[model samples]
Target: MGNAIHDNDSQMLYLKKRLNMFLEVLESVDPESTNLDDIDRMIEMVDDLEVKVHQFKKSE
Candidate 1:
């Protein structure tokens, strides 16, 4: 039981780290001077994260 909970906790922490990194990149973007390239990159990042979450859910 403890091991299972620890595993889940570790997974959650890693996910949180990914999310934080995404947020950092987004927050660093200059909204006033935003470009199509930046928009595309952000979209790609979110899409990647979405796929990861979907896979994680399917695993459980």
Candidate 2:
């Protein structure tokens, strides 16, 4: 129904917003910290977020 469509749209927007936020954090990474294991983890997390977002869209 119309309500389900509206809910999905809202959730999609929220997910996109979170993606942008993650991208921003990635962009702000300090070059000096790039050598650390945590940096690798952060990059992986962003990749995972992107994959999950794509999967969510496909599911919808």
Candidate 3:
């Protein structure tokens, strides 16, 4: 049980880190010349991370 809890915590931390990185990338993109493809990819990554976080919570 302790291991499971620890693993869950680690997963949450990783998700948060990934989300922050994605946000940073999004912020770095210039509004006047942002690539739609890059935005789409980042959005997908955020969605994927969200799903993983949700799954981790459910498992807990």
Each prediction's number of clashing residue pairs: 0, 0, 0
TM-score of each: 0.77, 0.52, 0.73
Can you tell me which runs of candidate 3 are displaced by over 4 Å? 1-6
After superposition, the stretches of candidate 1 with alpha carbons farther than 4 Å from their true spots are 1-7
**Which pairs of residues have clashing backbones in candidate 1?**
none
User: Ranking by TM-score, best first?
Assistant: 1, 3, 2
lDDT of 1 at 2: 32
- Residue pairs in candidate 3 whose N, alpha carbon or C atoms collide under 3 angstroms: none
Write model 3 residue lDDT over 4-29, tens digit each, in one string: 43476688777778888888888888
In candidate 2, stretches whose alpha carbon ends up further than 4 angstroms from where it belongs are 1-6
- Tell me which of candidates 1 and 2 scores higher on lDDT: 1
Please give the CA lDDT of all the candidate structures. 0.77, 0.71, 0.78
lDDT by residue (23-58, candidate 1, tens digit) is 999999989999999999899988987876776666
Ranking by lDDT: 3, 1, 2
Whose TM-score is greatest here? 1
- Ten contiguous residues minimizing lDDT sum, candidate 1: 1-10
Task: Find the 10 residues in a row with the least total lDDT in model 3.
Answer: 1-10
